[model samples]
Target: MKAKIHVSAAILATLCVISFFSITLLVELFGTLDQVAWIKSIIVFPGLFILIPAMAITGATGASLAKHRKGRLIQEKQKRMKIIAANGLLILIPSALVLHYWASLGQFNLAFYTVQVLELTAGFINASLMIMNANKGRKLAHK
Candidate 1:
């Protein structure tokens, strides 16, 4: 049951990050400024509500499960998750908030784009780390 919760929450959190990345790219490429603002608002509200809790649950369950385990893979997963969490808290969340604020005010200036780029980059980094963790987890499960 703990393992199940860990996997489910991890999947949810990963999907949210991917969704944010994809939507941001699509909107920036084809949508208008107003659309960007709307998307930013959407990303900040329902998106964070879902993502943050899912991540917390994932980490909590992962740590609980790892408590009894002894292996390098488990250590690696924990390390990766720590990095992911830091990236989200230190870079992604603040970037999202700044982007949303700038966009809300119709401030699609250099600063807005700058933060958008930063958010996307951090999101990509987190996504890649999460993928690596998931793959390692699969190997752990198989053994």
Candidate 2:
């Protein structure tokens, strides 16, 4: 049951980030400024509410499960989790907040685009890392 919870949480969190990345790209490419603002706000509000809790659950359950494990895969998963957490907290979250604020104010200037790019890049990296970690977890389980 615990393992199931961990896996589900991890996958949910990964999907959430991927969704954010994909939607942001679509909106940025074709949507109007109003659409961008709407997307930005949506990403921050309920999006964060969903993502942060899911990630927390994943991390907590993962740590509990991996506490007694020792191997290369375990080490890699741990390292990846740290990177994901740091990137989300340090880069992605702040970028999302800033972008939302600027976009809401109709400030679609160079800084907003620059930060949008940064957020997308960081989000992609984190999503990839989470997917890799999930693969490693499956391997660990089978072993």
Clashes of each: 0, 0
| lDDT digits (tens) for residues 46-113 of candidate 2 | 99999999999999999999999999999999999999999999999999999999998999999999
Q: Give a tens-digit lDDT track for model 1, residues 1-143.
A: 88899999999999999999999999999999999999999999999999999999999988898888998999899899989999999999999888989999999988888888889999999999999999998898888
Clashing pairs in 1: none
**134: Cα error in model 1, Å:** 0.7
Give the residue spans of candidate 1 off by over 4 A.
none
**What lDDT score belongs to each candidate, Candidate 1 first?**
0.93, 0.95
Show where candidate 2 strays beyond 4 Å: none
lDDT of residue 2 for candidate 1: 86
Q: Which candidate leads in TM-score? A: 2
